[model samples]
Target chain A: MAVLEVRGLEVRYPRASAPALRGIDLSLDRERLVVVGANGSGKTTLVRTVLGLVRPSAGWVRFDGRDVRTISGETGVSTNLAEVYRLISLPVRDLVEIVARLKGGDPAELEARLREFELGEVLGRRLFELSTGEQKIVGDLFAVSFGPRLVLLDEPFDNVDFSRRRRFVRLIRELRADLLLNTHELELIAQLDGWRLALMFEGRFLGPFAAADLDRLYLTRGTRADALAVMETSLGTFSVTRDSGDRPVKSATSLNALVESLA
Target chain B: MNLWRPYTKAMLANGSLWFWAFAFMAFWLAVGAFVESSGVGPGRSAVVAYTTSWYAVIVLLSLSMLAVAIANSLTYGSSALAYAFRFSRLTPEGYFGSIVGGSAVMGAALSFVLLGATAGMFGGRFRLLLLPADPAGLLAVSLLGGVFFMALAVTMILLVINYLGLKSTNFTGFLPLVLSITLGNAQIYLALPSWFVYGSPFNDLASLLYQGYAGTPATVELGAASVALTWEYLVVGILVWTAVLGASSLVLLRQIRSRQLEEGRQI
Candidate 1:
């Protein structure tokens, strides 16, 4: 069963001229899905909407065949490694316990996980007192304790150190939940196998592109045909159809490309 | 998940609670000592005044809430961790119970400290002050009464500000402390209204200290204490206010949840 399904999702901030997200359709099972986009592409909004942190303007989000908004959509291990919960003034242990209770995970399990990350010694320390990297590690550990059925991480590698990034990614990948990880770094998802990748731009799902093009998309951004030609020439192309109106449409290369071909 | 343990742990871990608790105790002790050495605090007839002296303790309880608010701003205030905590099955009731209950418990402990220090300062003369009020009423008013007032007043004050959309951790956290001190100080210089004085727990606590013990209450110069409301009326006020204060905490939880969610943050 699909653990998370979002269709025709639209989100508009109050008094904003443009929507943060337009009509975005997505589905995920237990598999890890990577959502990549430039800043302000609605990656965070999509994750927030799925977690019910932000109410959507239109469309529905279903989790494990249940409505996401109505189902008390707990963010099981949903945390952003890069940001500060600046208001958290308690010790790390208390924070972890809070997350545990929220997402239905065992506090004991969280403690054990913290020890694994060498964060056990610092658990007694206040969150605000910790270094940024230490705080990031603690936040990630709290999420791990949450262990909800669907985990959404926004910018999961933000404040983490270089050495710990890979390990953090590996640990999340090991969790037994459907993961919708929004990250700017494509290399972070390179280690996973059979992972579905998608691009969100101005709140629209632009691709479920093969994971093969994950890193190269940035190098080939332009008009549709130009981008595709560069992608094909540099890597390779698969004849794929995209959803248009009621039926899939096979769009031919653009006029600029056709003229280049005749030349 | 042991429900009480979280509240207990949080209360225990907060130095702010202990700081305010001990600070009030020391300050009260010092004042009592100063008054005795300088020959001032209570007159021979001022025995009742000593028993009712809980202003600092009340402020401490209110300050404790501010401390928690500030602390929470770091975690729940940030929104992401709040999102995790909210859906993770952490009941709003439990969270609130821990924060407010912890502060109340700390206040109760300080009351004991105040009682001990004040009696000692009077060279055992102050000990007999409780002989007039019913023992049960004295104990109830001294211990749980302060706890109830502190919890209700502080929680309501913080929640009202919270409802006003104040999000800055420093602002939300410290404003209560300032308000507690300000409102408390206001009564000192100002001839506060009778009903306002009566409703003001800090002003009326000494009077209400005898919750159920019936007697011809002697009038003391509790200038700010509400004199308009008779003692009988004050008794009903305590119970009603205590219950409402507790109930308001739940409302606070809802307000926080809805308001924070509106901002795409979790409470």
Candidate 2:
């Protein structure tokens, strides 16, 4: 059975002409589902609504074969405490232990995961003192370590490094929990293998697309002015660049020729 | 997850907690010394000047004022309460504990600190710890009373922090403290309504201390705290205030819990 299920979900903000979520239907089982969208495309609303932070105007959300509302409030950190929790004066060991215990998960298991990420030396130091990259790693660990049955992450890899993103992807892949990850970056979506990709725009889900289409989406903006082009995705235009007709240069990297030759 | 760990380890770990307690301790100590050397205040006797129930009233009032600042010492209110909610996430009883239990634990611990400091002051200026001037029986009653009042102080802090927050433009939180302190200072000749005078826990405590002793001379003889009111009366009055403050705290806490779930769910 699917661990989380949403059927015909509709969320209407008071006096808003358009619903935040319009008759959305989605489900989650034991797999990673990547949701990509433009800014304010209702990605967060869907996650927040399913997490029970936003009351839906219609339809229902079910988690673990029961109503999501019946389960509990949100499990992961919200944006308000995100910075505070990171900069909070507590040491890493205590924080990991506290979060693990609060989520009803195994602290020892989380410790083991942290060690796998080679975070043992940093555990004794305070979280605020850690570098931004290190903090992102800690955040990712905290989110998935508890092995929650269903996890909703909004922009999980936003501030993380490109080099570290793959490793973080591996870590998420190892999690027992099903994932509903929302992001604006197609790069993050492309890094994952065997993950379902969904599109959203203008407060609606445009539906899922094949992972094979990842490359074309990155063409949203061209490396140069003449290369830019657009293609239709579900409900919105996917911008791309035509690699073949770009001044017929050997590569786009050599703007050097134009600079030295002058206009 | 020991639900109490977060409240104590992180929320109470700040040095400001000690700063307030020690500052007040110094202020009260200075008062004790000044009155002894200068022979001022209502009572000529040093014991009356320092260890009287009137002083207890002052300490309670100070703690109330201090609770305002203490409540803001990072990792409190919505954040702390929300974390505590995790402990009882699936249970109704756990929910109540996280929201209300923080102050209960803190108030109980601080009561002992307050008692020790108040009693320790009887040791003179330099010494304020481990000195027992009051006999065991009377000291116990006084300490119990202190605990109830301290709990009330903590509740006031939580309510103000939850309601006024730091963003409030008005003095909603400070209104009561300002009135109580101002009215209480003028209480000597104010001739306010009887209920109003006694209604203030400060007044009742002062009256208890100001009145002459009825207890065995053994407890009063040590000269830290002297009680005029009967033991039964003191206990009943304190318990009544405890009940009153306890109920008030729960009411305020219900508001905090709802705020956490609804408006304060900032992400």
Candidate closest to the true structure, highest lDDT: 1
Cα misplacement distance, residue A154 of candidate 1 (Å): 2.1
Per-residue lDDT of candidate 2, residues A228-249 (tens digit): 4333333334333333422321
Winner by DockQ? 1
Model 2 segments more than 4 A misplaced: A7-23, A54-60, A65-89, A125-132, A212-263, B28-50, B65-166, B169-267
Summarize candidate 1's per-residue lDDT along A47-138 as a digit string, tens digits: 77776666788998887677764554344435553332332356777766665655566788988877887778888888767887777676
RMSD of 2: 8.4
Pairs of residues clashing in candidate 2: A219-A240, A220-A239
Q: Residue by residue across B33-91, what tens digits does model 2's lDDT show? A: 45543433343243443444434444445444444443433223344443333322323
Strongest candidate by TM-score: 1
Over B101-120, each residue of candidate 1 has an lDDT whose tens digit, in order, gives 65455545555554455545
Clashes of 2: 2
lDDT of 2: 0.53
TM value for model 1: 0.72
Error of 2 at A227 (Å): 25
